[model samples]
Target chain A: MRGFPSDEELMKRCKSGDLSAFELLVLRYKDEVMNFIYHVIGDYHRAEDLCQETFIKVFENAGNYRPRERFRSWLFTIAVNLCRNELRYRARHKAASLEDLLQADPLSERFLIDRADTPDMICEKKEREEIVRRAIESLPESQRMALVLREYDSLRYDEIASALGCSVSAVKSLIHRARQNLRKVLLKAGLGEGYNAGI
Target chain B: MPGYRLKCEEVREELSAYLDGEVPIWKRGLIRWHLMRCRDCAAEAFELRMVSRALRAWGDVTAPRSVVENVMRAVRLRRRKMEEERARLIARILRIAAPVAAGVIALLWITLLPAFYLSYERGKVRPLRDELVTVRVIPQSELEQLVEGRMF
Candidate 1:
């Protein structure tokens, strides 16, 4: 078995001014962190930028780290905070509307609909995907983060709470409320007992 | 939706916990029992679960390689900048402190040189004064007669 330094070990080294440890951390978490931010902002470019920013923060704040805590949770906490800041900026600046999300990464849009799909099938899938995306976009920021961290990232409730800067019960409540809202929207979009219908 | 003494609201509130497999065993049993009987709560739980499942179906994307490279480059630049800043601060402190230290030494020399000189002169004169006293060996009455103008 190959031996690897734990994140806490690397973080300790980083706190002592080791840039290599910081780089190692960035390399380790860039993908998942980027993906998390991508789910949040729905823009690959912005998500990638936030990933850089997140590491920069980790690098700068390494000195403040407590070795006893989980490093990944701390990393995601930073990432989540940066994502929230970006969201706040967007809201404050009246920047890109939710419609921008569909085309944020054009490749992803096509990835969902097969080339072999009939026009009607493609249209239906596109519509459903669009509704789902909009429903997600419509979610309150906190709820959206909770749902994203839970559903896509598969983080535990406690980890999600840590990342969200909320309590476990709050995390649960956020997910519950988010699901309730999504259910209402999806059902109103004419999904019935057929919600189990495969996408 | 509370009625007939059934905790429908409470069940709805915790259905998420139940779905997440986080509910305690007793509560899990209670929720399961409630879910078994109430059609409305059951449908609601089912729908929420489906929504959660649909969300999981959202695909994951890989971070671009450039992100890692750019972050590493930026971090290195920041580290260099920090080191340079620290060096500059030290140099600035030295620049300010060196002259202050020199001024303090010069001031101390100026203030205490006379005292040092007087102490040195006193050291030289003290032995000669002692030798004179020993050579004379005059008694107090004799010194008094000399001071009274009597010839020695």
Candidate 2:
């Protein structure tokens, strides 16, 4: 049975100046790309801007898109590279950290926890979420990227490897190291003993 | 390292892949068996799972409407600007080329075309016998007398 046009086909049309095809590609992957940037950067507004930049870059480089490559990984590679540059720029400037970035923005309360939980539970959940975010931010860049692609995006190990420009075994090791480091951070926060019981 | 400790290290490295189901069947079984017998490995596996769950707790987010609108707007502006730049380039080239083209045509009219016509008429209309008959050389005395009359 005929299904929808694939991403490569849309990309080919985009190369031929089809705006609608480009728009469809944007709509199809924008959210996921935004979420990825948000998780990696720990800031919503920056993620939104970077998401737009990512798509614009894709459009600009449409003529260079190779059909043999997987489009999703190619897209993620662009997003990841942008995230890397943003992080490096922040670091070079000695800018505010993730916590500061979050606290400074008054309208930055987008994370939705369980509604049934009491206020205390909600606060703990928020704290736990913050810890997770900081741990992820503390990881080495490649490790954090590999872990996020694996845990958040659920990309296959091979796909993550492709996006990171590494082998599958390297991806696995990066994820393992990321998790072990997170476990250390969780343990330090006193949440290691029964963290798995229920969050 | 001790034999069992060495075994534990290898299993620890593979635990992430094992949890991800990326390991082969037989290897997965070996890791499973190792985890079953080894308390430390089991705890490590459990911690990794918890970490994965914690990361997933962030949940899915929908891209805001502004993102799409802003992207399309930016793209349209860029494309329009590119087309304008292209038009400006062509106009610039023509601005320089038009006068040069007209000058080349004028140069050909002043030089090569008349020369070509004279050469063609000489070859086609003037015979060698007629050229010999019309060869009346003017005497130097008459030329000088004509110059003196004009001067006077």
Clashes of each: 0, 0
Clashing pairs in 1: none
Q: In model 2, what is the error at residue A136, expressed in angstroms?
A: 1.2
> Which candidate number would show the highest DockQ if scored against the true structure?
2
Query: What TM-score does prediction 1 earn?
Result: 0.82
Candidate 2, which CAPRI tier?
acceptable
Weakest lDDT window of 10 consecutive positions for candidate 2 chain B: B1-10
Model 2, position A129, has a per-residue lDDT of 72
Report the C-alpha lDDT of model 2 over A58-174, residue by residue, as the tens digit. Answer: 999988889999999999989999999998998899878766886875434456556688888878767777777777888999998888887778889988888888899899999
Name the 10 consecutive residues with the lowest summed lDDT in model 2 chain A. A105-114
Q: Please write out the lDDT profile of model 1 over residues A82-152, one tens digit for every residue.
A: 99999999999987766675666676675567778898977766676667777888899999998888777
Candidate 1 chain A: worst-modelled 10 consecutive residues by lDDT: A190-199
Deviation (Å) of B133 in candidate 1: 19
